[model samples]
Target: MTGRSGGFGDHSLKTLEESRKTYLQSLRVSTADATFFSHQNALRKFFSWYSPTANKPDSPGNTLAEFAKHLLTTLGQSVDTVAGHIHSLLNFLAFHHQSSPDELRVRLFSEIQLLSCPESAKESLSKEFGFQAGSEITRSVDALRAYLRQRQYGTRTHAYVELILAARARPTQIRLLNRSDLHLDEQTASIPLSETYLIAATGLHNEQTVDLPPDLTNVLETYIEHERKTPSQSGCQPLFTTIHGRASVGTLRRSVKLASEKARDYHCATRETNPDDRSPVDSVTAVVPSDIYRVALSDVENTS
Candidate 1:
């Protein structure tokens, strides 16, 4: 491999900064400014994954394939996203070997040319997150509400549930909520536009403000004034908190799911008690945080 004309000369130079710089410089002339930056970013990420500290791959094609698979399975990237990165990788590899002899190009292309995005990965993702119909979402909301009312649920939990049911807020947005975001006097909550970048990362819908219903506002007022603890000295004052201070998005999600589970159990117990009564048994739906958002969306569609 050494001393070959128009090929990467030294092993050290090939894997280090110089090789990457040469490829990026060649890319700059052929690509648009936006595309050049995109390629640069992709290359940076690829090199990071193929770390200088780690053992270098004998076959770059195999490394690329493994990287693509890692994106889908571990990083949870969409197929289109993984495809885009793969395209960037191909360009980087092709430009590096453009000046090399024909056989090198053939060897490289032979391994990578057949690398197509896997459709099965997308199907697996869909199966992992179960599909919830519109009717199921409504039933889930009803069951959760009935459970909260029947049991001695904490004011904080009850407030968040009521706010989502009324405001149609996403779990991320609700989790990011601060005490200052709530305006009990105005009967509204503000989702600051400044946090849009953070919110967008999680695929949660964000808006300027959400009008809270009177009943919902009252529940929040009670939670804030009584149940909520004093803000920590750490500076970030989250609207929702546990004994430890700010509650994580996972905690918020779990709270909603636990309530849904209890509601289903309660409904089942009630039906068993009155089996001979012959009245219609109320529907109790198992739900997650996303189902609540779907229910909220359904209500908006019905009204509009």
Candidate 2:
């Protein structure tokens, strides 16, 4: 707040409004009539909920994340809807960055690029992106599974991905898991899908558990022994932790976003119908973390 502080400062109300107006004016130059209006509408929706907190020092990475989740859960917005809103917010961040002091650009710009558009799609790719149906959700999940497994960091993040896609764990639940919480035994058991041990993961309800497959059990073991960093303090071990101790919410979100992006083998048209006749139809232009994220959120809601 004192001097830009390297990234967008929600702590300052005056600056946030000024920055929004400035960005909107600049956005007019690059965006068409529809695009510009759409973004303006999104910004209005955001400002309706965002009340500036005074002197609340927080990381931009984390603050923006909470803002996004609030839009989804509290505001009850869908992934694509939230994505459109975030896309607008991201541009505002970038535009503000350009006019801010130079040193702050590096960190501010990094947040912009990381949060911008979830994942990059080539211009050569077709438009029209979203998870249009429950079946499309399935396909996207499968694709994301494979993509996460193939990445080098995948070894580290793959377990959480499985928990999300298979077990339907929320980000908060994943963050709260301890290394010891996993009921993994060194001797592999021939467990069936339905019979696999429950995760005992704490969520909205305290007694939550989920089925874990043998392959994923192995992956968890490998991660614990090889990929995971040893905790400095005796009580610090988490089921999945970054070098920073615990995976930040932003890290978890971005990991899911990357997986979703990679899952898109080809760009979809600007509009396309869901092929499933059984489920209600929707046309989506992009797949994002929320597609995966909402599963866990809904799971908790249903169970609760």
lDDT (0 to 1) per candidate: 0.60, 0.50
Among the numbered candidates, top lDDT falls to 1
**Could you give candidate 2's per-residue lDDT for residues 190-266 as a string of tens digits?**
11111111111111112234446677787787788788876555665776677667777788777667656644532
Candidate that scores best on TM-score: 1
List CA RMSD, all candidates. Answer: 17.4, 18.3
Minimal lDDT window, size 10, model 1:
98-107
How well does candidate 1 score on lDDT at residue 196?
29
lDDT score of residue 260 within candidate 2 = 63
State every prediction's TM-score relative to the real structure: 0.50, 0.40
Per-residue lDDT of model 1, residues 1-304, tens digit only: 1111122334353554665786577557754788778878778777767653465444544556556667877777876776667666654553343211112222333334344446585354223322334665676577688778668344677877877666655566677789988888987777542232322222221244667778787778778878887755578788899867788778878888888888888877867887674534556667887787656544542332
Clash numbers, per candidate: 0, 9
Off by over 4 Å in 1: 1-132, 193-207, 272-283
Cα displacement (Å) at residue 263, model 2: 3.3
Candidate 1 accuracy as TM-score:
0.50
